[model samples]
Target: MLTEAQAWQALDAVEDPEIPVVSVTELGIVREVVAEGDALRVVVTPTYSGCPATELIAESIVDALKAAGAGAVTVETRLSPAWSTDWIADDARAKLRAYGIVPPQSAAPGGGQVVRFMSRTLPCPRCGSTRTTRLSEFGSTACKALYRCEDCREPFEYFKPI
Candidate 1:
């Protein structure tokens, strides 16, 4: 039988396919974990509906839980109450910064509204410079934007706020 704590522990090792440095749990994708007898069910909310790594993430979750002694595992996708970047763990933000990717800023202070059209400068993850310019709305991944720092002349990706 799999315990809820054990299921969660297994999931904590499941890293995001796109961002290897962070686990799905750290990204706030794993919303719930339920263990019933030897079966386990996990509720996940992707960063966006069209996220390319959604399938891969689901597979990873199932594999991890099964390896952790679950007899059966099911992953459920929840789209309602859509995922928010504000859900990201604080420690994950530091890990993103260390990995040279700018983590998304919180939108809670603004009533959970993010203005996508407005151009805003994000500090460089490498040099901590506000003199940065967005090179493209999309970066290596759809959830990230390409940016370059004027101070260090380093190109980095900024995780877009949902």
Candidate 2:
């Protein structure tokens, strides 16, 4: 009979499969958790609709809660409001930058305008410099962009804002 708070703590312990340093909660994917009688319901929003790690994250949540003595844990995926970099916590952003991945910049409010083509000026996560060049639009994953710092001359990945 774990409380909702307890269940959240348990799920927070479950790290993201791809980014082991950040937990699923920190990634802002765990939207809501409800204790329904003998079962716990967890709502998750994927980083992207086609993200391959969504299933793994769901499985990790279930395993974590069950291991914490929670009964009948259920994971629900919600795609309505979609996940955004703005939902990412401050602590998580710091961790992401420290982990050598540039945390996404906060998008403008009501940013619904479609762009035909736009170049984003991103700061280098390693050298804290604005002099950087985009090496590729896709990095190790579809959610990231590859960049190289002109100052430090180090190639790094930038988590694209979505």
Candidate 3:
């Protein structure tokens, strides 16, 4: 019988398909791990709906648990309470930055409503400068935005805040 804690620890070895620098748990994708009888169930919430990596992530989880000596591993997808960037672990944020992807920032209190109309300046992941301009609303992935640093003159991807 695999313990919940053991299952989570095993999952630590599973990295996010999109961001290889961080584990799925570090990315806040693994919400819950429970052992039910002989089966281990992993609950996951995707960064966003319609994410192309969802199926791949699920398969990775199942394979990881099985390889860890788990019995009858099951993956459950939960989308009710939409996943938010706020759920991202602080350590994961640092990893993302170190990996050359700007991490998402928490929405300002009472500033969420205005964000829809106003654009926010994103600091460059490489140069650490706020004087970055958006090259496009989309980047290498649908979840990111393309930006170029004014100081470094380098193009980078900003993990869009959700």
> How many clashes in each structure?
0, 0, 0
Models 1 onward score TM values of 0.91, 0.91, 0.90
Mind giving the per-residue lDDT tens digits that candidate 3 earns over 24-108?
Answer: 9987889999899989989999886778988999999999888888999889889867777777889989999999998887642
For model 1, the stretches where C-alpha displacement exceeds 4 angstroms are: 108-117
List CA RMSD, all candidates: 2.1, 1.8, 2.1
RMSD of 2: 1.8
Superposed by TM-score, candidate 3 places the C-alpha of residue 100 at a distance from the truth, in angstroms, of: 0.6
Shift of residue 50 alpha carbon in model 3, Å: 1.6
lDDT of 2 by residue, 4-109 (tens): 9999899778887877778889988999999999899999998877789999989989889988999898899899797887887889888989999998876723
Comparing 1 with 3 on TM-score, the higher-scoring candidate is 1
Which digits, one per residue and each the tens of the lDDT, describe model 1 over residues 16-120? 999999999999999998877778889999887788999999999989888878888889989977888899999999999999999986563346565666568
Clashing pairs in 3: none
lDDT (Cα atoms) of all candidates against the true structure:
0.88, 0.86, 0.85
- The deviation in Å at residue 10 for candidate 3 is 0.9
